[model samples]
Target: MADSTSQPPRKLAPPRFIPPALSETAYPALKTGSGFVSRNVTVRAWGGDEKLSDTQRVQASGLAGCISGTTGGLMRGPRNILPGAFVFTLGGILGQLGLNKYLRHQAQQPAPGPQEPLTERILSSKWSPFSRLSDEKYIEIMEEKILRAEADIALIDDRISDLRLKIQERDQRASTDINK
Candidate 1:
């Protein structure tokens, strides 16, 4: 019997936001504008590449976003400036959300191990419709699969035998009762 003290397997939590990789880029225009502003305005404003911190980056991005958004809005219509301010704010929030989700995903991912030369060679093989495994490795994989199939067949046979035994016992009892 299983131990009563053993805990149930813990389930992983559903992610709070969709992973950045799966989702569409949130506000492409904002991103392009922010980048342009960062490259032009922020660089000039802050005296160019002093190795900014994360806070600084966000601040610069916000400033750049505001400048670009305001300019775009102003160019579109004089009346749009007020609405553009609100949109700029919303865009900043959404950009932050996207960045945060991306960072979390990066943090959660396991660091990949260095690839073995043989494995790398096999993966890089140019041969179409054919595996690049060595003859021994191919044989080993097939043997492993055959062993697994044999084990599954053994378990199924055992179940069938058990069921047949139960049926025979039931039949014998019924026959005996009828005779009696």
Candidate 2:
């Protein structure tokens, strides 16, 4: 048998002599938006730079609202133009403001505690259905299951034995016929 305690073989080192042009072309050093120097280039976020003032963000949100409102107004007949634009624009602004507030609040709040293991959580929770059962009751249920499984296995074994006997009889009959 092979020795399980033996150390694994070391990985081979890459060749030192990479062409300068190939190296520069393949792995050019690029600065990320977060100001980290990395070998791979990253795509910029939508609307170019990350530094947007509150006014700019609000304006962009308002512009989006206007576009959505105009689209909605167009969808509803020309008769409902004024009403659609007014309602949709107001709704969009309110929705955007609510979303921004929610995001800010979420950001301000402390992160949640480390999660409990599923089994531990289930056993500990008072609301869990299984939590109502005592350890002794659980053990009793498991024991009943084991007994049922053993009974099933016994039945399967008996059936297998019967099948083996039938197979043996079939072989014997076939052999006798061949001899004749």
Candidate 3:
């Protein structure tokens, strides 16, 4: 007894391939295959069957900083888009607190590690960032940044006052409608 059975071909899903990392091997300097041509070549191209360049390694290292985000075929490097990347975050914060603008820029580009606390960065002598300024001129610029900061704070306060007025009007309208 022969049991006739036929299974239709299963629709094959399209393949999605992720590129594997390149191999790691150092290509040493070796003489070319030309029997006695007295020529010294100190450099050679590093493509195909050779090692990756230092730049490629550095870029790969930067990507490792964001490994958790690369699962499901997505690529979002951590350093590329940090959490608090708002350009003027420090400015807005100091403005809210009525701080000086000189302090804001100074705080932003502090002298220490590229991203360190303001006080620490300023005090680290080894990371001094004074090259961009002259002592006499720096004093004058500081005054200007502080004055601008004060003006910005005043403007924000005025805006807040106007918002308060609008809120009061909306409240009054709601009260009148409830009474009716």
lDDT of 1 by residue, 15-77 (tens): 423345533563455446555755467656766556655565566666666766665555445
The lDDT of model 1 is 0.69
Worst lDDT run of 10 residues, candidate 2, spans 31-40
Considering only N, C-alpha and C atoms within 3 Å, which residue pairs clash in candidate 2? none
Write one digit per residue (lDDT tens) for candidate 2, span 73-147.
Answer: 444446555665566557656765777788789989999999988998988888887665779999999999999
Model 3, 22-135: lDDT tens digits are 211211111111101111111122342135444433333233322212221122233423432232233233333343445457779847745867666566656776434569
27, model 3: CA deviation in Å?
A: 15
* True lDDT of residue 26, candidate 2: 31
Better of 2 and 3 by TM-score: 2
How do the predictions measure up, each by TM-score?
A: 0.40, 0.43, 0.28
Judging by lDDT, tell me the better candidate of 1 and 3.
Answer: 1
Count residue pairs with overlapping backbones in model 3. 0
Best by TM-score: 2
Give the C-alpha lDDT of model 2: 0.59
Candidate maximizing lDDT: 1
**Per-model lDDT:** 0.69, 0.59, 0.44
| Model 2, runs deviating above 4 Å | 1-50, 117-123, 132-180
